[model samples]
Target: MLHAFRLAAVICAVLPCAALAHPHVFVDVSLTLRYDAQGRLAGIDEVWAYDELYSLLMLTEAGVEGTVDPGQMAALRGLDANWDPLNGGRLTVEPPDGPAVLAQPRHLSTQWQGNRMVTRRRHALSPPVAGDGPVFVRVYDPTYYVDFAMPSQVVIQGRAGCQASLQSGQTRGQDDAYAATLRAALAQELDRAGPDDVQVDIGAVGADSIAVSCGR
Candidate 1:
């Protein structure tokens, strides 16, 4: 698990933009949240799942590891990482620097509102370098995440449902509208948070990255 954390920390750093290439993608993603036994997020886990893969990618590119599992690995885009001495912390990154870093509110939590958790979670800040997100990355673990609308719903490769998730309710042309509504609700929730209570960043990196490191 520690190895996976180290690997993911590295991957999110290297692939700052997220590299989900398949439509019917099955990513084993997870989050390292500061939670209790009942399963509640109280913190964040930057590095998880992708430790070996990242090391392998480095080896494959360097010609050290001969014959890599192309099927086992997906392409990563941007996952930059940065180490902050002032905060004594490291962060994964993509663009616009990184996500805001703050603390999760003592009572802040995600509440299910209809099909999704319409409430904002006081998630940990994204790493200055290798951060995470898709609506506040690393806030919730795989079990808590509802992103996988159809883990078994396989569509054609490259098609919306086949490779990537089509959002919570984006089946029809109104996907745009649905997304807007969700974002609006999220923004409202985030708006009430204190700057020191949470961090904000971007990187719609698919659940694949999140899935890989659920327990690590």
Candidate 2:
């Protein structure tokens, strides 16, 4: 998925302004917040389901065709080789009191779910975050070039007293508004840009996230 959109980005540079106004890849995410027996934050298990277009692109890139089998699914597992470190592998954990670091994703796996491609992986929180305060997990691209919907399903494990809540950041209405704003901005930037250079800095202003709180 990452590689697919990075190529789109390059194409956007020379295409019409409309092409640069929205994300090229869409993903729906699910998360499992894990805690150790000691009740400290251990890691997160995540599943990402890509939109059909991107899924097809991914499969084609992997040299796969229709009706993917188990062996083909297994072969597609480690495709995150193009994951960008700058985006924290498209995820991050925000502890209530400290700075969040880029997590390393492990145990990569993938499968075909109908027309979508679902990928799973783990992000272990080293040193194990210890606190009763809420910890936030965010799935987003700072530049908004890849739109990742926050976890639609959240599960808690190993912590009986912990509760997880989903907080949506960008609703469809809000995204429509944002896209309008971005289109105008991109148009203005393009007017002032050199013939071959057009750059605009987009931040993750409305990223959706999940929060988990545990009792002592």
Candidate 3:
């Protein structure tokens, strides 16, 4: 599974001027905010469902066919086990009062859902975040190579009086149609090559976020 991104990089190098902009893969993300007995933020549980095309590619790489069994699935764990520290496992968790920290991903399990692959993982926050303020979360690839579709709702366990809501980072106050158009444009820009000295700011344009808050 880790080879998937490496394969994409190879493809990118081979085709520099192609329309292969960002987002070669799409993922559906579901998040759960976990709390400890003291009602403090403990960690995050995530379930990532890959798109049909990506899933097929993964299975092919693993030499798997048809619906995979438990044993086969077990062999396919740690897809992102070796993740780039810069990307922080492609997940951003910002505590209200302190600086955000990158988390290492621990692979839980994997399963086959139709043609897609559904995998689970957990990120433990050391010292756990304790506050009633909002804790913002985002799932994104800094290089914009993968697009993550954030869930509409977040599940909160081990805590009461807590609420989670989806907040658009860049597309806030924008219509759906316009937001889609903007994201498409950004992809083209990301694919475009320019002077080496020039740096393109990866603005949180299309990055989706989930904000959670407990108590008043």
Candidate 4:
């Protein structure tokens, strides 16, 4: 997914304003908040299902047709093992002082789910933060290079008293502003002989965030 995001970022950085408004790839994400036996927040399980178009592109890049062969599947697994999406600054975990960074992921795997590519991974929360109150988590590419949606409901595993809710990010006006900013950045990059120094925080455009509350 990060690979696709980077490719889209480059396209947005070099393309004209007309082409910078839309996302090149789309993913539907389902996040599960996991708790340890002692009821402490241990980790999160994420499933990212790629859109058919993007899945086809990935298959083509992997030199596979129809179902992936064993070699192709191994290659996909290797890609997931090497790419650490949690540290990409796209996922944010709020814990009062600031956003908390998660630890390394486990049980990371990717496979073809029907015609789409689906990636599943478990990200261990650093320091094993307790879920005693509301925890805000947002999964999105700050650049908005790849649009992410939660089509399925968020699940809380092993905690009967826990509940999760979705909060929509970005109004129509904010989305428009985000598109304009991307266009401007891309244009500026094209004009400069060297790399442009401008930094765009596309996070302001809004994000599809989730709030998890555990009642002890």
Which candidate number has the best TM-score? 4
How many residue pairs clash in all the candidates, one count each?
45, 0, 0, 0
Model 2 lDDT, residue 14, Cα: 74
- Model 2: weakest 10-residue lDDT segment is 194-203
Model 1's alpha-carbon lDDT is 0.28
Query: Any runs in candidate 1 off by more than 4 Å, and if so which?
Result: 1-27, 35-42, 47-56, 66-216
TM-score of each: 0.23, 0.72, 0.72, 0.75
- The order by descending lDDT is 2, 3, 4, 1
User: At residue 37, what lDDT does model 2 achieve?
Assistant: 76
Q: Provide the lDDT at 214 for model 1.
A: 20
| Greater-TM-score candidate between 2 and 4 | 4
| Whole-model lDDT per candidate | 0.28, 0.69, 0.68, 0.66
Per-residue accuracy of model 3 over 59-101 as CA lDDT, tens digit each: 8888887668888986566454226644322777888676465
- The digit string of per-residue lDDT tens for model 1 on 17-102 reads 12321122111233333433333223443322223444445345545333434432232211211122112112221223444455
lDDT of 4: 0.66
Model 2: how far is 123 from its true place, Å? Answer: 0.8
* Residue 42, candidate 2: C-alpha displacement in angstroms: 1.1
Tens digits of per-residue lDDT, candidate 2, 81-197, equal 326654323677889777455466776678888899888888888778874758888877655566787865588888887777878774443354444544544454546552333
Error of 4 at 124 (Å): 0.9
